[model samples]
Target chain A: MPPAALSVHLSIGQAYAWSVFKPPLESALGLSGTQSALPFQLGIVMLGLSAAFGGTLVERNGPRWAMTVALICFSSGFLLSSLGAATEQYWLIVLGYGFVGGIGLGIGYISPVSTLIKWFPDRPGMATGIAIMGFGGGALIASPWSAQMLESFGSDSSGIALAFLVHGLSYAVFMLLGVLLVRVPRSEKPVESAPSAFEGPQVSARNAVRTPQFWCLWVVLCMNVTAGIGILEKAAPMITDFFKGTSTPVSVSAAAGFVALLSAANMAGRIGWSSTSDLIGRKNIYRLYLGVGAVMYGLIALFGDSSKPLFILCALVILSFYGGGFATVPAYLKDLFGTYQVGAIHGRLLTAWSTAGVLGPLIVNWIADRQEEAGKSGSALYGLSFVIMIGLLVVGFVANELVRPVDVRHHIPAPREAADVGARQQPESA
Target chain B: MSEHDSSQSPPDRRPLIALAWVWVGAPLAYGLYELVQKATQLFTG
Candidate 1:
């Protein structure tokens, strides 16, 4: 299951590596940075939308069926992009990669999550962690690989088209392994997974939205992702900006290095911190991600340009919390909603990610633009944004504190004793 | 194979398990290697 899950995630995880195509596309297509950014942005929006809308279908069809659809949509998106590149029709690329491919991203991201949790009921956090870590690391594989392709293929339209062709076909082949390999539990219900003290009733995706707990987690995930992604989107520039007037001014290569290091932290955190959640529990892990994560932001804001290592260390920790936040959420959902309809519920929860995807970059870029207009330079450019991120994290922390077990009213009839416990305990607790 | 035995242990799946891990691990390692080469510039530069 882990390998099969990785086959799916690692392939679709290439979304993060889309930046490698930007400069080449800009040169080839005469695009602005903002224009080049459109497809990736739209892809993220579609990721959230598709996941929210498609979650129920995926649950109904099963992982094999889901993987097949993902393979087709994702691969065809690339093939279409290849044709778009060949014709130099930028809108075709957007439609292919953004609209069509984004559906693949959304479906593929959630495909293995519920199944892994169901299989590894005893360590749901670790199970989901192993799968999701691939999503974080996908860029590491694709970024350099894509760059090498561009280098070898000459960055022309034909070259870009060829690259897209290879990505489409190879990923299609890789994802098929997952389609062939994955299997659901032999038992009708996955063994009653109650790994933590804050276990909630087994709730269907339909009933989950009515409970305050779901919304609280929504806020929690939204704020956590928002804080982390803000730094991530601007990492290279942010590092360079910090030491703009310093003696040890950061070179562009060094800043790129900083970005890579942060990516590593993000990937490692997905596996390391999430697996840790299995022992420490999900809510407690989130307390670390949100509570301490805010402090890391405060540290970056306060200690500006004083020590390069300190700034890098703080940023890396925050990014790890970001990745950990993503990896751990599925288990967190399972803890609150149970295995029933968790995939669907998780899909709904990803709407928060789509929201944060827009929200995080907007806050950072808007504030920076304003500050730049006002002649603010150095860390001053990001001071207000950091403060806002810290505030958002605080808000998320409060929401996490407000999380309680789901009310029994939302629960599906449990297959075992776990059902009786929820039924009897504080029936209208919400 | 008995259901109890299948439930308790699948004794002969080690080679397939290792192969699966290697399949994913090799590419991941290559990616990590490239990333490390890039990341080293942060300190060394």
Candidate 2:
């Protein structure tokens, strides 16, 4: 399940490395920076939308169907984008890569999540974490490859089209493995909350939204994502500005290195800390993420310029928590909402990610722009943003604390109705 | 008999599973190598 999930995730994760295309696209298409950014931005927005909308269908159809759809949509997106590049039709690139490809990202992203939890009820976090880690790590593999492609083939129309063609074909073949390997594990009885302390509500996706628990988790996710992205979106410049006043100013190479380290931390935390959640319990783990994360932000705000090592360490740890938060939430949903409609519920929760995608960079960039206009430099430029991040973390902590078991009214009234989920007659060889 | 048998002789799937892991692991290893190569510039720079 993990390997199958990974095939899709690693393929789509290239969305994060879209910056590799920005310079080439600008030169080739005579595009502005923001124009080049449109496809990636739209991809994220589409990812959230498709996941939320398509989740129920994924649940109803089963993973094999879901994976096949992902392969078709995602690969076609690249092909269409290739044609767009060849023709110099910028709108085609946007529609193909951003709109169509984003749908692929959304569907591919959630395809394996609920199945993994169902497969390893005892270690839900670890199972999903391994796969989600692939998404985070995907950019690492893609960055150099995309750069190489652009170098070998000029970033011009024909060259870019050829690169997109190779990517599309390769991803199609790779994603096919997922379609072949994924199994809708024979649904046993609803996971016995059992002797385990983690047992809680069995709310359906529809009713889950009505309860305050859903919104609380929503707020928790939104705030956590906002804080992490605040740093990530501006990592290179933030690091450079933080230390410009110091004796050792951050070189561009060092700043690039810092971004790579954050990527590593993000990937590692996805697998490492999420597995830890299986042991410590989801709620307690979140307390550590939100609470400690806030302190890390506060420290950076107060004394970040005092030392480079401290600033770097704080940022790395916070980023790990950021990554951890992403990997842990599905299991957390399982604990609160049960495995009943976890995939559908997980899909809904991604709207928070879309929200943060917009808000995180806007808040950081806006404040930084204003501060620059006010003659601020170095660490001073971002002090208020860190404070705001800290405030967001504190809010997330409160939301995490407020998370409690769902009331009995939300559970499926009968045992048979509960058992009927994902228990289709189709045999699964997981 | 081949190490990976479809017959129900406990159908030793270790090799198949190992191959699966390797398929995913190889690319991840490449990504990690690049990541480390780039990350070293932090202290060196």
Candidate 3:
């Protein structure tokens, strides 16, 4: 199950590395920074929309069907994007990578989650953690690989198109492994007989969204993701700006290294912190992610320019929290609502990620661009953004605090009712 | 199948499990290597 999850996640996680293509696309296609970001931004938007709309279908048809659909859309998005680059049509790129590929990401992201939770009932956190960690690690592989490809092939439109074609073909083949290997648990019965951490009444995906607990979690996820992405989206440039005039000024290569380090932190946090949540309880672990995260942002804002080590350490911790937030949320959902329809609930929850994907980069980049226009240098460029992130994390902390067990009225009446409803509601194959 | 019977059911299953682990681990391992290579640039360059 973990392997199946990893195959899909590692392929789709390439979205995080889209920034590596930004400069080349901007130069070759004559686009502004905002224009270059449009594909990635729209892809995230589509990811949320597709996941939300497709969530119930995914739940109905099961993981194999969902994963197969993801494989086709994601691979085809790359092929279409290649044509877009070759033709120099920006809209094609957006349609291919953003709209089509985003659907792949959305479905692919949720595909294995519920199955893993069911298979590993005793440790939902660890189960989900292993798979989601691959999503964070995807960029670690793709960044250098894409960079090397562009270097070898030249950074022209034709070269970029070729790279896209290769990516599409390779990822399609890779994701197929997931489709073949994945299996729903043979027996629907809970593996563990003892009372586990996620003891709760089950909730259907349709009813789960109507509850206040779900909405509170939506806010919590949005704020946490927004805070983390603020740093992640700007990691390369922000570090250089922070130490522009220092004795050990950050070079472009070093800035790239910093991005790699952040990726490592992000991947590690997903596995480490989410696994920790199993022991500490989900709510308490989130308090650490939000409350401690706010403190980390404060440290960066206050003293980051004075010391590079302090800056890097603080950034790593913040990125870890960011990864932890993604990895832990599925288990948290299970804790509140039970395993029934968790994939759909998780798909619905990812809308918060889409929201943050847009809002985070906008807040950070807009502020930094304005600061640059105002002749700000060093830490001053990101100071306001960090303060805003701190404020956002504080709000998330409050939302996490307010989270409680879902009301019993929202739960499906019995296990058999859930099974019957699921069987009845099964949708046509994608 | 009983636990003992399942344990002895198929010798082929061991190879399949190993192959599956390799399929999953290879990409992750390669990713880690690339990250390490990138990180080394921070010190060497």
Give the Å error, residue A277, model 3.
Answer: 0.7
Candidate 2 regions with alpha-carbon error over 4 angstroms: A189-200, A425-430, B1-10
As for candidate 3, its clashing pairs are: none
Residues A309-371, candidate 1: write the lDDT tens digits.
Answer: 889999999999999999999999998888667888999999999889889999999999999
Rank all candidate structures by their DockQ, best first, as comma-separated numbers.
1, 2, 3
Error of 1 at A211 (Å): 1.0
Instruction: Please tell me which predicted candidate would have the highest DockQ against the true structure.
Output: 1
lDDT for predicted candidate 2 compared with the true structure: 0.85
> For model 1 chain A, where is the 10-residue window of minimal lDDT?
A421-430
Candidate 1: pairs in clash: none
Task: Assess each model's interface with DockQ, reporting 2 decimals per model.
Answer: 0.39, 0.34, 0.32
Q: Which regions of candidate 3 deviate over 4 angstroms?
A: A27-30, A86-90, A191-199, A372-375, A419-430, B1-11
lDDT at A14, model 1: 94
Q: Report the number of backbone clashes for model 1.
A: 0
Candidate 3 docking band: acceptable
CAPRI level of candidate 2: acceptable
For residue A259, model 1's alpha carbon misses the true position, in angstroms, by 0.4
Between candidates 2 and 3, the one scoring higher on DockQ is 2
What RMSD value applies to candidate 3?
A: 3.5
TM-scores for every predicted model: 0.93, 0.95, 0.91
Instruction: Name the better of 1 and 3 by DockQ.
Output: 1
* Worst lDDT 10-window in candidate 3 chain B: B1-10
